[model samples]
Target: MTDDLDTPVLDNHLHLDPRHGRGVDAVKDFVRLGGTHLLVVNKPSWHLGVEPDEPTDFRPVFEETLDAVAAANEVLPGRAWPVLGVHPGLISRLVDDRGFSPEDARDLMQGGIEVASEFVADGDALALKSGRPHYDVSDAVWAASNAVTRRAFELGAALDCAVQLHTEASEDLTDLAAAAEEVGLDPTRVVKHYAEGRLAGLTPSVMSEKDRLERAAESGEPFLMETDYVDDPEKPGMVLGPKTVPRRVRWLLEAGYDDAVRRAHVETPRAVYEIDTESTLNRDT
Candidate 1:
């Protein structure tokens, strides 16, 4: 049903990894399903062996992400953008498997921040990504993770791009906003990715869960929605498919929450991530 709709929506977070063989099909399918824009993140590297050197060494992954954006634009110009950073889970893996000392890990993370900034500065990325206090990590690793996350926020301040945070669902985000402010980044620029509840006083990029989606819509709070679609063939549509957000919007529209759908699909994304929805959708048409 969403495939026939013309309403503009942005899937603010998704991974279009070639490793998974989704490639352009993923991007095309998303566009066909009424997704007018996307923010493609670097593929998580925890599955790869530990990266022990400077973030510049991660150039290939960042390049791949850019390539995905390029490919999407080729299919539908201005349809996609990139978000670059070292995944927080990869940080924990490096500490556990590679025996990277805390200081060394911090150094590596700083390198990542530098790399992310370069991409944003070059207009190749719209934001930086990182997470603090990843629950899967040990306390020591979590400390290192938070340090890296803070550095990312600092970079966001300098570069004037948003920072997408991968964090535990429903966690309090006041401290995160405070950290952003401390680093001179506007708290509104810090987006909590994969959020599942009402993140009072913070912005969230939410996923598709009917009850949670309903709750967020009813709250009349400003927020964005995402599928977090992994694009893995092994677990096809694992979190959600490309069409999920559009279908949700359809529900919102029918439920008399048209303004909520617009806020979530258009206004929040434009304000938080700087997407030009009008231009993107116009190009598609």
Candidate 2:
């Protein structure tokens, strides 16, 4: 694929896990395939099926992820950028031996407005997890996770980074007030990465595309549409694949929600939560 291909929408939720053996070459190939900016999001600790849930064979994927970004920068010059944060499902890793840090625990109790506002108020995007919308406890967690969620948010926001989440059916977030309250992260502080995408082995029903938009507007958060791909087709959507980006972009356009699609995966996200763009900028931790 070359840049001469379709008009590339901003690549919002492209996830590259070192565990998957993706290289900087793939990143350049994406840009060469017509992408303007490629936002490399956080992935599960390792490869699916072959790797354990958390990485036991290697160090945290974050470090390798940063290395890949460095390679991407070298390969594409100003294209590959980094987006850092913990996934809701992976929040377990962020917790100490006890659990989520006390601050995060408290934030989870309150609505996260004040707690999250304090952390990354200086950063880019406030990344948080809304779990699955259909789940009962997720609503409670959404109202709570905000405490420390924004610390990372501000860090990214200060750099104009976008918050991209890996959501599941049990992680439905169509209700703005309900979702924001449930996860405890400030909806206004970040853009959700995959509020409308389909999850594996789950029903296709969503919080109605129209209602999803209204929720985004009400929460003051930009919505993101992404292809959380897995390279092994045996895994399908587990990792962000090379073929999925444009295909999903076309899906959004055909739905006549191109503008919403663009903001979630492109414009707003790039302009806000991704300071890791361009290899030369190098902000990987």
Candidate 3:
């Protein structure tokens, strides 16, 4: 795939586990296939072999994620930035395996996001990742997870950065949008990661797929595209391939989606993450 596109091709949600996956090579695959920017989100604590008993325990998790981002940037400078925080699924582990109460688990997760906010505050990262568990769970656990998500929104507001949410597959974010508003964050700044496009009241970082892209493009509502590439060797190309975003961009362009492509890749990201992705890619090129 040629990298001759005029606008930047950005993958909004990606993970690079150097220990157990293609890691930087996966990122290289994206860059080689015309991807110009990546928001490298942190994998779960357990994925990196960390069992957090306290908030500071997440330090290693964030550090290693940042290391992976650094490694990616070393090879492809100005291409990757981090979105660090505890994965919401870890709450199940904390309450089930680690023997913590639901409330404690929720607080721990919030604390983890708070720790992550320090990196954003220091300007080491661009966004924060947090959300409730996508799978089924008890009511108490669900409540706790929602609380953690709200804490993430509050932190995002304080840092004046975006929050990338990994939640259930639902288009209605009415409640979450209200929570963000309640916390003094602009609801538009909250991105629903792994989103199905045309979300009710927030930015949808829709997964890169033909039909989904078509619908999102036709809707005329601003949205971003992502591969959500997990980069796991065992489950290689789990969610989507690393090159999916750039490849889809090409497909959309061929289908005469120039305005949609520009809106998704450049306008939405600049408005949400406050990054000049197109200009940044232009300068780097």
Model 2 residue 235 CA deviation (Å) reads 2.3
Reference-based lDDT, each prediction:
0.78, 0.43, 0.89
Q: Which candidate do you rate higher for TM-score, 2 or 3?
A: 3
The runs of at least 3 residues in candidate 3 whose Cα sits more than 4 Å from the true structure, single-residue gaps closed, are 282-285
Tens digit per residue, CA lDDT, model 2, 200-277: 221111222344444443443444444544444346444445545555555555666556554554444445443333
Each model's backbone clash number: 0, 49, 0
- Per-residue accuracy of model 3 over 1-285 as CA lDDT, tens digit each: 446567788899989998889988887788777777889999988988889988999998998888999888765533789999889999999999888999999988999999999999999989999998889999999999999999999999998999999999998988999999999999899999888867997899999989888989999998999988888888878899897898999999999999999999889999999998856774353
Candidates ranked, most accurate by lDDT first: 3, 1, 2
Give the poorly placed runs of model 1, Cα more than 4 Å off. Answer: 47-52, 283-285
lDDT of 2 at 244: 52
Which prediction has more favorable lDDT, 2 or 3? 3
lDDT of 1: 0.78
Extract clashing residue pairs from model 3.
none
TM-score of each: 0.93, 0.53, 0.96
